[model samples]
Target chain A: MLLLSRHLDQAPNYRADVQHFLFGREFRAEDLPFSEKLIRAHVKNGFISLRPGIMPLNENIFDLLGIRKKWLCARCGNRDQEAFAFCSCARCGKKCVYCRHCLNMGIVRSCTQLVTWQGPEPGFDRAFLDGRPLCKWDGVLSNEQQAAATAMKRTLAARESFLMWAVTGSGKTEIMYPAIEGQLRQGHHVALATPRTDVVRELLPRLRAAFPDVPISGLYGGSEEENLRAPLVISTAHQLIRYAGRFDCVFIDEVDAFPFHFDPMLEYAVHKAAKPGTPFAYLSATPPSELKNRFLSGSLKGVKLARRYHGHPLPIPRFRWIGSWQKLVQRGKLPSVLHEWLKNKMEAQQQVFVFVPSVSTAAALTELLQRNGFSRSAGVHSEDPLRHQKVADFRSGKLRLLVTTTILERGVTIANVQVGVVGADDPIFDEAALVQISGRVGRSAAYPNGDVVFFHNGKTLSMVRAVRHMVQMNQEGDR
Target chain B: MERCLFCGEMRGDPLSFHNLFSPEYAPGFCLSCREQLVPIDPRHCCRLCGRDLSRLDRNRVTEGTCSDCVKWANSGRNGLYVNNHALYHYNPFLKEMINQFKFRGDVRLADGFAAELTRAYRRIVHNCVREQSGILKRKPSFLLVPVPLSSERLLERGFNQADVLARQIGAPIVQALVRVRDEAKQSKKNRAERMRLRATPFQLNEKAAVSLSGHKILLIDDIYTTGATMRLAAEALAPARPDSIRSLTLIHG
Candidate 1:
């Protein structure tokens, strides 16, 4: 009813109506978001049921013009007829066709109506800046970071997408703070998204501390934060698939990360989330070749921060010949060379991460390491229920080392930890993964240098390419 | 041309000539997604329930039977039905497929399992006909009873998966039972609670009651989890005094 809409508008903050009646769209009875008791009350009072479970309440004649009648994903603009599949929704006791493209987030059935506010928009007050100074990070940005931030802000003002080709540990998050604050001061919404949830976790505290006065919300799977309108939203890239033209400025951190680099659907989601013609700045340590070519041709805007914020060179991984590690593993013994290396690291009290190609190998290495008198080590993979706890225990100095699969290859940082990849020749351990593993080292300024070793049975092109890429980054840092 | 019945994807080798030599070959699904349907390893399974025994703790098994079956035997309901035979594991993939088949009214999916069910039917019931006739027989004097759904559920879901499966098994299907009450879906309940609820929801159809006497009955269903539904159905059918009762399920959770 119009009275209900008015009551909602009078509230302290705007509440996005997740369920409302829309004209011209065929919706099922069961997909209604409200409880049956509430629907019963509305029905009793005079609301007409269009069908068994569908309500055809009159709101505005113009609202019907914007209603999408056909089966299409309002969030991701996915119209591929084959992308939809029939699902028997428990809530709506009918055979509902759902969008399979974004099924990982949650099912969005075709017969289900995703209705937001159709009333007049609310105006946000200047109370967010009520005599409080903006851009409140106590730590000052480095000269390189400041220059990159200026360039990024300029491109945002021009309404053009730009690439921020910053190396690992280059303070990319801090560099975006100025642009976020500028956008917020102008009453424009801004979003910071990364492809990995761990990175979102690491960024939340830093962003909150940097802008303590502003209202910020973090969106990720299982996050308990309220999902209301906010000036600054920090989320994982997958969460952006649900948003629709809500942001004026978007920053896609780790643009080249897994499930986002080669995934065209995620890229389409990024575009769908941003307002038309709005700017997006892609920040990645290793930009994909497509983006790099566009930057080279001057078709896309670009900025680069070559050096680490701590003024140290990126660690170059050196290869070591360890013949038939799998054979030695089957015998319950490590390679002689690797055994000596582990002994020296343990003797020096160095925390380490031993990367393997698969979960089984990680378990095998963990067993072998423990058998070799390294009882404080543990193995972890994606399916491990205690994965987060193990990482925390390792960070708190309770564990001396960890044997992990590629799940931990990116978005994890431990201080003063040496890195080693057991099967560098495996196809799963690609050049991007190797580069990310090396980036895990030399992360903290307290220990700006560490060793990265690729203990391989034989060399592969990916291994050579990773080594060369790291060396090239270091060379550029010197300039 | 054979195609994957799940997503309608075309199989790479639609006609594997080697299949001609292998009687077990059934080109039902494409290789790209065929791994989703995980077959149960008969070697490492509970002798009584056909559940994958590898997942159970070593101390939980006694005399080649899982703890659930041991509990069932202790409850004095062991003779209600013969051992249940399941074809696949009730994994997430199978759960989704079954959900689409039953709740979503995708009746065409039942055709995908026609060959396998026919094979199981011949191995279980047809062998008896062969022993009596001294030759491969075309028909057996056995009643195929599909687990009945309540009238309300029949209206909601539009079809019963067990009926479809039994029809595909190529035997004479007999709707000899009816549900007196519309119990909530077993999927919404926990395993322990589902097993403990000893209520029988079925009653013998009066018209088919006389024929059930002295006839072997084979119960058909989609999944065998905790064995509560089939046990209750068998208990309900005991009044007719069938000679024997058995069950065949598509998946074992």
Candidate 2:
């Protein structure tokens, strides 16, 4: 066991205080905040020992607080037995079963002791943050934006959960600033969590500029801001697995986004990370139906911002028939109309986003486009390591077109860019994804409107509903 | 009903629980993921080291032995290990799997390779029974001894990869050796440095040595990289005076 301690010490950034590691929830030894020796001593003294290696200090306190068995993981929420395995754990030195569902995040074994903060509440000095305006956003908001912001501030003050069902391009990020400011003024820690890393990258610069005086940090995998214990944290939802009862308020951006919307464990993590009775808000252009139902049934308080931040209607997607796109691409050609559309967009100096269904298709289409004299065009997919640099090139106008997968469907904003879904009817492009893709076209106030085309082999209900949904929102915006 | 042990993705073609557990029916991975796993063809392997020799010219193997084995034979250390059998070529897929098993602490991955390993052990046991003649005829008895991990490495990895592999053989296992000192991981060292790493980290466990007195030993490991560890281990076991020792590894580099 002592030999194991030396190995535990080898963990990078390992701290020595069990309290820091265990606070807010239980933790595996691999993610320890304190020295393994200290934790082992605690376990030896019966202060903590659950499954085997999992040690939570002060078990009696957890019992008193009614902390139940965390059978379901707080990250990715995988409760299936298939996603778990029994192993001879070195930490516990016993046969222990660990959750494999969220293993990629870190091991979550049955005996893995999660630590929660049991001591006096962590409070920041309000005076330290005084004299300076908490929010530095000097621009005035539109009526709907102002209303949503006020409601957000009120919800934070009341410490109640709320939802902002804002449409795409409705300045959802800006709307949360006032509420975030209110929380910061009260010296409360705030977390702005989103589902994707790209959003985290996009929000970090904007948030840093908005609250320069505030110690703000962005949390994501491979993020440099990880070590910063800032009062305000902008993080991807996946990064929230390490936190426990740490935030006073958690604002989840794009609650309907992939992995977060689908994985229950992310929701569990949100509950675990936020302090008890803390305020939270779900900000999404197209929230999941369950959340919508909750809001409709008066179980949730929410606001709707239908119009774009630039006060223009969302660019409604126009469907163009292109029969058997798979066959066309396989035949080394594009649909005549779509090819003409791409040529026109390129001729007019407009950057284009051509969303394909898969990586191979993206490559094939990019090859076809390049061969057809569109030399500045390239394909970008999730597996493409150069996707970031390619996106940067597209943004700087060095590249005229980017053929991509759904990875770029959301949270990408390029001014004067025409958007096209080559396989709009493909099941992968759900209503939410289509809405997000269209939202990308008319984001910038300078170029508030651009063409959004859905070139498909056949019409599908999702496509029709997406078109109807956008036009309906545009009509609602008129009010 | 069957799912990938790693990713939890359900197999498109459902497998019964019995079939799922059976090595012949399921390889413990989904079809897409299984593409990464390339089994070493036995016909294409070196006689001594079990290294894939298909890429080498037939002339390179003199008298059914690779140049490495010939060198060891010439060095008079061929008796250090009777024969080494390995199941896989050390490919990137196996490397990633080993990473999960040894480094990431996902110990259940041991079960994924267990069935096939046990089958291989049984075949070796059968071979031993057939060649029960001369000095080998002293006993049909055998002891399974997994190469011991240093105390520090053991503490870090929690469980030894070789030990886990040996356990899957379903043979009686003994902790016959204790590591006297920890050395840098072999993977981190350059080839020359690894070749020069001659100091034996192992010492015979006196208590367990009594059990190994006259028995044939089946040394087990996760990978047969430089073959230096096995040489040192055999030298360390010389005191116990085991009649003979053979090694079985999950992979051969």
Candidate 3:
């Protein structure tokens, strides 16, 4: 193998091996396992290209005036001067600046070199393109879903970005099946990227089951699978930082979710992960105003599905005044109104989702509920180490109630589950979050109706806007 | 426009006359991040290890000395080594900060503690001057000797955290020791195992040992947990016949 790598001009398979790893991914020189000689041979052969990992910030008129110096991270496109720091580098033996924003991925210093392949694309396994359907899922989509799916397929084939403005529980994942199958049959690489790890975990099994014959790899923070050559990849947006121009078609699920909506780095990752002019499909219940304005102006092709797959109206949140719930919980007492509502749900043998404004409130309320004979309840926050186990136990009906923060407001579905938002007046539950929290109920067709109550000390505009938003969606669904 | 090195928030230091007239102010941390670092008060700390005696149980602290220091003193391992002066108490926040600096390769975080390390080093020098009154007419300078790591470990971690921290003290650093054995991390060992005197993992560099013949050596490390590592390091420097040995650590667990 060493001899073959050394004589790269004579060894055809050796060049293919380099291309296989570097095809669409941008990797640091140290991250690649190959020796420098072989990589240099590839570079000499015009099969590989290298660029500095960090570059000077684009020169403006002020920069020409010699005002200040700035740098940009080529990997994550971070131009924030605050996110860069200089240190005495051990590798370069000089003062090196690195981007701290994407430091968790890998340290990209000014002296580091990023390598990418400029060679011909490797051929994918086209055995599945023998006129047989790729999707094996037997479930049928609703008429609205079918229409939106068709529009997505058409727009994506035309190489145009499309947005699926669908409500929660609108079978958004199922709508992408046809488009994904179309992409896969043509031997094109497709990816489903989401903001949160929970959403990726939730979508992985469903996507795998739908396309059993295709090789699927799921990427997350600590995921064990590292196979990047798979044609269909499901990963969190953070994992896409290492990829460049990889996917021919990318579907961003939950485009307006936390960290993704507020962080521009994830957006840059998605853009870098896809080939230029590659079509993007954005699926969201509540897109940020930028995308909404673009869609409303008809500049972007899209479809809106107001109705859910179950054809049931979304459970509009009903506001109930509960005086100072935080003080009550702190005083080791559940609010009377919320207590009565939970008791009624418990007596009816229904599981409950008690959403709190913060982790401390969730912990206190979980303990208070357990003390009040709700012994099977548990609290889960983003920092909880046993969060996965607790969520699994709740899903399996081993736990009667789950008290959670906004971490579980989306991408979680439990049948016949009723929601009670403690301190809904808190600023943490914005209009988008409240809609997502209420959308958690009435998800399954078996139990198409569940109660959603906002137990608040005082009604805020967000609460009113959330209710109004759901009511308008319901009106549109009726039409 | 300066941002906190830890939390990335604006430092927001008011433009007072002192700050305006002072030499270029180094960006350190935000007020909230800085408040999390619980500094060990010199008056209320164990005299030997500089640990906060107020936080320890009364039974464990007797006459301004912690029980661990008492045990060390009785063990007769203090050849020419003195005590350790730690800057802060080992809280979870500092533990995380150290983890980032020492393990995650965020070497820039060392700049955040430059002022504190310099202040602690100055206090040590001042105390040394007061102890040896007229024999040392001027402030005696100590050579900074950061605890060395094995070559394998240094390659793995990219940089020695102690060396980075020692550089911030603005003192002449002497590489007088090299780690001969790649032992397991001191953090993974229990207190009893660490306290048990065993073969030292350090060896004196013959080239640098000649310069350390009579100078005061101050060993720098991220944390002084059991003081066993410090004692073992000092024992390694015994062959050099240094006049005295002391340590300055960022935390006392």
Candidate 4:
């Protein structure tokens, strides 16, 4: 048998009868590199031997790098990968073989994870749209939804790009019907995306009625719309992560919301999901500071609908003092003044929304309201599995006076809702949240105006600012 | 002088490190080699059942993939090439030769494995080497991976069984991933759940992760049973940007 000490460019035929064999050791201060010792072991095995007169069989450092036992390329005997290209193996379907260019593209073959896509989905209906929704058109166009519809129709017909920075209840959904129809007529795809599920459930029925002919896919977790091979995709931002450059046009509804704003991965996912040079239009009422800076810097496009189509002035919520909500709830009591106000609203056949600071507050107040003759009130929080159903119950008028935390503060709509905050001074009820909570009232066109009463122990700057902000948004709308 | 043990296959060349480690010289042999020389070859036994090829049912599922994988080839939708590298079938002399080297610590038995592997060739090895060379004739990127040992087992054994062969093969070995899960030894678990849990745990850290991206991974192990370990590791690596993957084993357990 032959033994080859791994001295590259050494004279060949270096064979000797073995007296003793010794492997490299950690015992001494300087052990040879791990790769060199492995090459020596290979030299130790007859698996390879020095061909006489040749400088061993190969001369590549990576081959002798001791990383893999068979470091030699099965194709060529090149030492470094930069010298080769890569392509898929024709014989073997899953394997990638290197030619020359492959070495440079970082061709690492990973074990493939095989997932079976269940195939294309079926249910989609888009027929005659009801009154082609035109929202936030001209301030006096009370019936000018047709104009809003016209503008949207023109945008989709030409694939014209635009943003919709309309405030809450400015009828963002109503404005989309014509755009969706345009996509159906033009044979293109359009997607409306919002991060909130409450909004999805609220919009599904409306979309079903509007686009009764074209197929529409409502995408979110637990949705089996795998085969959304349709013209419309309404999806949450997180679901966009799996796709790579698929959608033609992406409309980001509530693009300024939490995970989309806070997570870079979600942003990367969205970027990857869209086609090259495709238009991404965002609809946000209250955008983040970054968005405002970008918009001001002329880095992004901006559009706005400043007035509520209902034309009624945005309600000003007045703040009054109440000591401690926990104390108020202990005796199954309702604040005398607040109770009288709710009683008057109920007598007038209007709905009241009692917005509490926490789920605990909602539960305590729901019981207290029931005990004090407001027996129709029910507490709603995310912890309830039937939360969606309960909200539906409220919308259907099966329940009245819904007491809730921030869960129903956005994404849900109810007509003639008079919103009241139990502890408006608490910082948990920040300016943005306060505005959304207040916006809950007077959403639908049926009742254009509703009262907003905010009760607190002390007047907070947030409360003052939220009311000012609501009035300013309304004024901006009226502009 | 240890009778200049196991060096018979070297064209009777004078002893050297090559001959010392070569199965030809310090050829690893079973204790029975003193009586009869056993043979070794590329494994023909089912990687799943480890059943002898003569006993293959042709209808058996072979657990995870051995059956379906072969059938799915070229269909385009979902398929993989080749069944597995672990189909150890050799003559009596080769088996005796390998068992002695492995069990008796006749570390030089690598030559016997190499020789028997070369023998089972029937011209296939040279043709494969030629064809592979035609494509990857350049600096061949081999992600030579030592079969991972559970941290506990690796610490206890002080060496990986797979590394022993990789050393003899003269290839680069990546110790990039570790099996965090202490999967019950393969002999015990047969279900896919065990495979999923075990497969995902073989995760890559930063360096292994970097090197793994777009690499040609050669999953080196000592045995293949149910191919659970190999398949799991391959699946885990599939997302890491490896260009392709194949496994090489010293013997089928």
> What DockQ would candidate 4 receive versus the native complex?
0.01
Stretches of model 3 off by over 4 angstroms after superposition: A1-18, A35-41, B1-4, B9-26, B30-80, B89-92, B134-137, B148-158, B174-214, B225-242
Rank candidates, lDDT, best first: 3, 2, 1, 4
Query: Please, what are the lDDT tens digits per residue for candidate 2 over residues B113-165?
Result: 87778887887777788887665453266689999988878866667878888
What are the clashing pairs of model 3?
none
Error of 3 at A47 (Å): 3.7
**Model 1 chain A weakest 10-residue run by lDDT:** A18-27
> What DockQ does model 1 achieve?
0.14
TM-score of each: 0.74, 0.89, 0.89, 0.48
* Interface Cα RMSD of candidate 2: 2.1
The 10-residue segment with the lowest total lDDT in model 3 chain B: B132-141
Write model 3 residue lDDT over A1-479, tens digit each, in one string. Answer: 88878897565433778898998999988789899999998888788999999998856877656666788999998988878877777666778888888776667888889999888898777666678788999999988899999999989988999999998899999999999998887688998999999999999999889988888989998898577568999999999988898899999999999999678899999999999999999999998788889999999899988999989999888889999878887889878898899889999999999999998888889999999988889999999999999999999999999999999999998889999999999999999999999999999999999899999888999999999999999999999
Best by lDDT: 3
Q: What lDDT score goes with residue A352 in model 4? A: 81
- Give the DockQ ranking, best first: 2, 3, 1, 4
* TM-score between model 2 and native: 0.89
The two-chain DockQ for each candidate, comma-separated, is 0.14, 0.50, 0.40, 0.01
Worst 10 residues of 1 chain B by lDDT: B127-136
The residue ranges of model 1 lying beyond 4 angstroms of the native Cα positions read A1-32, A35-119, A122-126, A262-264, B1-16, B19-85, B88-114, B127-138, B141-180, B187-219, B225-247, B251-253
After TM-score superposition, the amount by which residue A458's alpha carbon in candidate 1 deviates from its true location, in angstroms, is 3.3
Q: Report the Cα lDDT for residue A323, model 3.
A: 94
Which of candidates 2 and 3 is the stronger one according to lDDT? 3
